[model samples]
Target chain A: MSQAAAAPLPPSHREPRTERGRRTHRAILDAAAHEFGTRGYHDTGITHITARAGVALGSFYTWFESKEAVFRALVADLSAQVRDHVGPHVAAAPDGLAAEEAGLAHFLAFARQQKLIYRIIDEAEFVAPDAFRAHYETTAARILTRLQAAAAKGEIRADVSEAHAWAIMGMNVFLGLRYGIWDDSAATTAVAQTANSMLRDGLKP
Target chain B: MSQAAAAPLPPSHREPRTERGRRTHRAILDAAAHEFGTRGYHDTGITHITARAGVALGSFYTWFESKEAVFRALVADLSAQVRDHVGPHVAAAPDGLAAEEAGLAHFLAFARQQKLIYRIIDEAEFVAPDAFRAHYETTAARILTRLQAAAAKGEIRADVSEAHAWAIMGMNVFLGLRYGIWDDSAATTAVAQTANSMLRDGLKP
Candidate 1:
């Protein structure tokens, strides 16, 4: 467990770098994401990522200590990017459902862009576990806060909270799993429609 | 795929097996379940299962053709048990929200009793994927039909259709994933409440 904690960055002889060094670092991450997207986190090797990035093995060590570190950094970067992409959609919308619909559209588009996240969530069940929940909790928390704002506006259900946030987050994950893994083409539209319906109507049966 | 197409037994293996054979077979299944639950399907070995059961290797092979056969048997047995247990609760509930809530309770109880379903879902994500989708799709079909029934009864929004049905099913899956993998103590109640809220209220602002 301590090792798990140590993984985020841990201690490294790796020097923090300027733009050129950062360029090298970003290259490693981009290459790692591509490799992970294809081979999966568990099946992929550091050598594979380094080789694909066309960087020396020592360069990877300079950026990250373990494969887990590389993965964690990749995930962190992904979250930041997702949040950045989702932020405006949520902010620009006028109402709860509208905001949610817009936010979800952004998420789905982002999900399409980053097959890496899909791969991580998929294989996370086996390989780099806790990453799913860990990735999700942060995402869920932000979503809850956003929904809470709507509740304050008396637009959505005031009672909705973290639990609901997590549940819906799960919905997005499963949607991706179904469509991405199993190649559900039209099903993706069906999923989007469902999410839109829920965002608009809630489950008022 | 052929065996998948093979007509399923009529939800029973009660061909009046001899007591000794039945007992030994049960022991093997129990051991295999535990092995798969703990070590995962891909990671568990036939020897470990046999060792755990205190049965000879020859005996294990006698009862099952291979590890897949053992896993298939266990999954088939557990899937039937879950369907049987959930059948009444799902039937008793008359509306979408009620059905979803009853389902949450039944699903949690089913997972508690069969603890292995959790492992099976997790492991099957990689090892026995078709099995994962088969059970979930079957369960999803049941839920979809129930939701449709509720809609027919005017218990839910008429506009919601098979797509919403799939979302409900997707919601349950995330519930199981969270409860099983994250070790979150608040999960069962949280997801149940969330499901209830989502079904009854939607995320409308």
Candidate 2:
């Protein structure tokens, strides 16, 4: 789980004033994820998002001023969604190391169900560089915090740092890509167990 | 070093047969790496590469048939360059575990010097999906081979599998991006040592 909402949306984006407005805002963002995920940012247009969203053209413009604006919001939205989905699993785990495994397993499941998440986030690298950087930086920071908490409790190594956090994040991201999005032949539970064992014992025989 | 040349140049690429031809071929690839790395594949043109290579347009045609062809070759070349640059260091290390640290330290240095490597290889994710997959698959396979060898020798955990190889690769890749490409403030050896400690001792307190 990460703090995707750490960065606030820019003032350029209009906030919803009513329940109906919020639903419309969310609908457009969901549609944007699908459109941008499938067609890519360069190929996707505002019309494509509006059409898929089943929202009026006026509504998209009501929340987002342009394609770039909505794309940025979509990245943030997806980041938050992953956090929401994975946070509980991590919280449920009994320890810091177990939390890592639980987080990864749930994340893999989420990735499988929402494969578009990868495409949208990966595309953000070129489409919205700032959001892309923020996503990873924020995610790594969260991992570092958890590691520190674990160390405080004497649950893990005492010398954990930002580097360890990034290393774990990298491991989770690639493992998710390979097993979750690319192919689902391997069991997510099994994959997580293998990785967590390494987390537990390194490579010692 | 990885044998980038192990893969045959597709018939589309006209291999150079003479010493001067080989020099010309090498120059064009180096130039393409620069152009594609800087301008990106879509923005880069054959003329841009030739101009940068200080070679005639005819010379480009003598080697690569099209921009896509050259881009494919460039991905392979970069993949090979990383392997070659990092391989000797891994070889010099006394054990499988030490080899990983050596490989990562050298890889960080290579990434710092060849920052475009990340951009080019990343862009290949979209431009040349096959090449991008091949680059990682081959690299992972190499790591898996070493891990299996180490396991056989009882130098590491007996259960080290492809998952472990991918995990280590993921760690190295993100570490390279954060420390190598993004900033040079952190010492490569220090960063590698931190990660290697995790590999050597897990996260146990």
Models 1 onward score TM values of 0.83, 0.95
> What TM-score would you give candidate 2 relative to the actual structure?
0.95
Model 1: colliding residue pairs: A155-B205, A156-B205, A202-B202, A203-B199, A203-B200, A203-B202
Which parts of model 2 have CA positions greater than 4 angstroms off? A1-12, B1-11
In the predicted model 2, the residue pairs found to clash are none
For each candidate, what's the DockQ? 0.49, 0.60
TM-score of chain B as predicted in candidate 2: 0.94
What would the DockQ be for model 1? 0.49
- CAPRI category for model 1: acceptable
Candidate 2 clash total? 0
lDDT of 2 by residue, A104-186 (tens): 99988999999998878877877787788788888888899999999999999999998999899999998987788777788
Share of reference contacts found in each model = 0.60, 0.82
lDDT by residue for model 1 (B1-205), tens: 1234223433322322688878878888889889998888778999999999999998887778789878877777677787788788877976667777878767776676676676675566556656666765666566667777777788876666545655676667666655643444655655686678777877664
